[model samples]
Target: MLSKDALDTLFTNARTHNAWLDKPVTDAQLQEIYDLMKWGSTSANCSPARIVFVRSDAEKQKLLGCVSQGNFEKTKTAPVTAIIGMDMEFFEKLPQLFPHADARSWFAGNQANIDATAFRNSSLQGAYFMLAARAVGLDCGPMSGFDADKLNAVFFAGTTVKVNFICNLGYGDAQQLFPRSPRLSFDEACKIV
Candidate 1:
């Protein structure tokens, strides 16, 4: 089992940062985050999450155009912004990913099944991405305040991938964090079988 400090790093004390320090997130660190998050579970091992780390000024500028005004400044200032996307064609690789079974045949021509699996599994991967970022000593500011159609055009124009959400990653400014908000109690938010 993980120690208390590790648990705190992953969950209890981790905060969604809105302000970032002036530090760079290296390509190696970004790769490390992916290498960790890639191990997360997905339906049928379909593993549909695709990430684009926007660090260059050119890419960041393109991304800035699609975000809501509320998200603009923080996104612009963060060391890197990860565009989490879902591959609509993810099932094609199921033969390679879930090789033990003919998982590819299950959704090859079925649009509804493909869409449901891609979106759900990719969303789960996005959560795993955030935890992996924290594990790598990076702060995350995840947000959905962006124009998906515009972002898809900018990042994945002719591909079958669709934008899931975006997250800014870097060292955060602690002074900028707000007070931690309340969460639902287990009795209020959960149920026993």
Candidate 2:
């Protein structure tokens, strides 16, 4: 088991930051985060999360136009805004990812299953991404207040992928955090068979 502080870094004390410091997140740190997150479990190993790290001012502006007013400034000020997307054709890579069996055939003609798996696994990956960022000493602000159609059009043109959400990454300004909300207890949230 990880130490208490290690767990705190990944979950207990991690906050969804809306305000950022002027510090820039390094590209190497982004790569390191991916290295950690990609190892997270996925059904059929369908690692479908495709991320576009919008770092430059020009790229950030493009993304800014796609978000709600509440998210615009937060995203703009953050060092990186990860456009977390899922590849519709992720099953095509099953041969490489889950080579023990012909996994690609399982979703080849089933659009419904493909959509479900892609969305589910990608969302899982996004969660892993947030935790990984925190483990690497960066704070995360995952946002869903964005126009998916506009974001897809602007960032994922000519691709079968679609946006899952946007996450701003940086060293955050602690003063801007809202009080931490309460979570349900184990009895309230879980039921053992």
Q: Give lDDT per model, in order.
A: 0.97, 0.95
Q: lDDT: which candidate is best?
A: 1
Error of 1 at 142 (Å): 0.5
lDDT of 1 by residue, 6-69 (tens): 9999999999999999999999999999999999999999999999999999999999999999
State in Å the error of residue 180, model 1.
Answer: 0.9
Q: Which tens-of-lDDT digit does each residue in 1-193 have in candidate 2?
A: 9999999888898888999999989999999999999999999999999999999889888899999999988988999999999999999999999999999999999999999999999999999999999989999999999999999999999998999998999999999999999999999999999
Model 2 TM: 0.98
Candidate 2 weakest ten by summed lDDT: 56-65
Most TM-score-accurate candidate? 1
Give candidate 1 misplaced runs (Cα > 4 Å): none
Error of 2 at 174 (Å): 0.7
lDDT of 1: 0.97
CA error at residue 143 for candidate 1, angstroms: 0.5
